[model samples]
Target chain A: MALSDVYDFYRRMEDENVILSFKGEFTSELLTSILHIMETKMVTMGISPKMKKRVFNVLVECFQNLYHHIEATGDSPKQIALQKSALIMVIHENEKIIVRTGNYIPSNGIEKLKERLSFVNGLTEEKLRELYQNRLLKNKLSSKGTAGLGLIDIARKSKNKLGFEFIEINENTSFFCLDVVIE
Target chain B: MEILLLEGSAKTPEINFNQDTGVLELRGRSIPENSIEFFKPLNDWVDIYGSSPKETTQIEVRLEYFNTSSSKCILDLFKRLEQLDGNSTEVKVNWYFEKDDEDMEEAGVDYEAIVDLPFKIIEVEEI
Candidate 1:
């Protein structure tokens, strides 16, 4: 990354109205600190309390999704390297805030991830609420104690279909990006 | 047994389970990195509290935010209270939210739908 390249990226972030953009390895400790920063930032902005709460909640779910997915990756040098470069960006636009995260997913997992995203985005509000309720009752947490409720909750909170893309990085892995927009 | 009081941190909720007063309170943010571990003792406390009857059990939840993992643990805690509700123990959950926060209020409503316990969604001027 050249100095000019860094400046260019900074300019682009500013152009996009990014409030925060983080690119690095994500650990549980780092997640807490980032959340604290976000909370303080929201408070400083003096946005509506309800809006602040919505953005904060969406950010938490996004960070946890990244944290859990990264932890699930086995200890391969390449995977770890890829994990360290994961990106999260929070942008404010058109009276709405957008929380976006990008990370690597093993090729085999991309299909399932896409399907789940599609399923969540496809549901009507009533069905989504029903699904959330049923999942709350029946969805057993994985060994990591995540009940796979992150996506559904994000959808519910955002009240928008999730935006996602999978870029083919290589034969064995892909870059997965997810965005939730909160109004 | 004894009262269970755990201080809140940046990532975990404050838990004050008073066996004597039957006023169990969970407050602050609950986005702990290891929510299962953080909430284990609370679950165990609920189990013990459920077994021993109190004339009235009141749970006050005033969380600013919680991640998905913590949400599961919260449901588990509420389930324990629901169990107590069945056996003649008057269990009530006072879910508090900031007056401007409809999302938190809705979260309380979500829990109310899932758990068969009486919930009082109270809106305060500020948390």
Candidate 2:
């Protein structure tokens, strides 16, 4: 949290081509503001309106996924603190925008998520569209307000594989990170 | 039998559901943290309106962006409109997208394929 440390972090972010990032509590209100900043940044960049709209859509889905991903955290103070620090960062690389998010999830939940991500990433565009529609018709919304279509929607929108990793934090918890590309 | 009107916010959509006219309009963004909760009343209204609906029920969806959660709820809202079985109501949806927003257009197409209602995917200058 020192000034030089902050300067070094800024330098590293610049080096890595990170345009925007947040690492803290992910509330709906806060995410809305983050999206506003991103939309404004895109407007200032003078990118085409089409690309701006597409990137904004992808960003909303990413944060909504994060909302569903980490909102059901453990209630203990330490666990709450750890879960509150969910991460979202946007990277501009090679004329493509990459949106990434990270959050803590129960270790037991990893299998289902991993399966779903792989399922989404492994499909062709046609099959992906069909799968998305099928899921849309079949699955009901869960108690967390997700219908299991977030990954599929992200995959279809990006037209690229969804990159993801899970770092084990403890026997009962793991840190899940997801990267989605916006072309 | 009252009109349901809710103003839009940074993370929610503007809703104008007229029970008498059977003209429901949903505009703006719908990225609420919990869309199921946000849309429950509207969905139920569709069901209640089904009980005594106008001859033509027109729904206009001019959403700039909606989260995945809202996407499902939006579909459910459409499904409710589709399930109105009486001859008194003929339901249709106008899913409007900005001309440059191919994603929004495709979103309309996606819903059209899944929901068994008449959908007119129209292109507009802006929402």
Candidate 3:
């Protein structure tokens, strides 16, 4: 089988309709460019103004997560390597916008990620609202990295399940794909 | 009193405040790397301006986007203005949002809910 065949199978199983595909070094410039393009498209498509903001907000959070957790090796081998990766966005027939982002994840980080996803996925809408309000009241002044509330914010905004899949690339690394949908 | 103008970056917004005219404006995105560090001085300036209240103080906020932390700081700023209600100064807040941007309009309403001040939500065409 060819590489496209593998991608096709995975795409079918994930129930994603790939409308845009990109693969390159995930630099800050590239991320911002992508956001700008997406925002333009959202406006052109006549998406509601509220939904446009929501889409942009979700994109920023997801891209930041990929940047923070990407694996790398060099002079600073253990440093979070700002390497290139593949990002795919799909618009489902049901009017749901799905974003699939893939990046190299350290093998040891899988369990922690799973735990966080599980905790976020278990919350009801009311519970998530309470958590958000509580965080706002008690933790607004805290810095971003220190709080690690990005995942919770994503969960609350998306109002969808966080679906993830891992492919073991080698013993020390794995290609992790995260799927988030905005309906 | 001096007018300090700052441009917006990928993380922050453009800040324009004129002490002479008492016209303060913040527009564009706001997701600064450090929320407190970025907003502390702005808050301080508002406090200083509130002391010797101007005859007509107008604050225009036309932010396209801001993170939750920045939202709190904005609330604090509005509260400060609300405190100067009976003073000789006439304070007015004009929150501008895109014509179809309901999220921004709702945010304006949310800020209005907390402060007892003259706040107006204006819809503008996207430039």
Question: In order, what is each prediction's RMSD in angstroms?
Answer: 1.9, 2.1, 4.8
The regions of model 2 sitting more than 4 angstroms off are A71-76, A169-173
Best-to-worst ranking by TM-score: 1, 2, 3
Rank order (by lDDT, best first): 2, 1, 3
lDDT of 1 by residue, A63-143 (tens): 878877773455888756765568999998888889999988888998888999999988998899889888888988887
User: Which lDDT tens digits does candidate 2 get at residues B45-112?
Assistant: 88778888999999999998888788888988888888883458898899999988888898899998
What is candidate 1's TM-score for chain B alone?
A: 0.95
* DockQ, structure candidate 1: 0.77
Q: Pick the candidate with the highest TM-score.
A: 1
DockQ of 3: 0.34
Where does model 3 exceed 4 Å of error?
A: A1-16, A69-94, A140-147, A168-172, B7-11, B31-44, B47-58, B68-96, B109-127
User: Candidate 2: deviation at residue B117, Å?
Assistant: 2.0
| Interface RMSD (Cα, Å) for model 1 | 1.3
Clash count in backbone of candidate 2: 0
Q: Which stretch of 10 consecutive residues in model 2 chain A shows the poorest summed lDDT? A: A65-74
lDDT of 1 at B58: 95
Cα lDDT, model 3, residue B47: 74
CAPRI-style grade of the A/B interface in model 3: acceptable
State in Å the error of residue A83, model 2. Answer: 3.3
Choose 1 or 3, whichever is better by TM-score.
Answer: 1
| Per-residue accuracy of model 3 over A50-163 as CA lDDT, tens digit each | 676776777777776665546566455334433445564646447777777787777788889888888889999778766755565456454544235567777766779888
lDDT: worst 10-residue window of model 1 chain B = B80-89
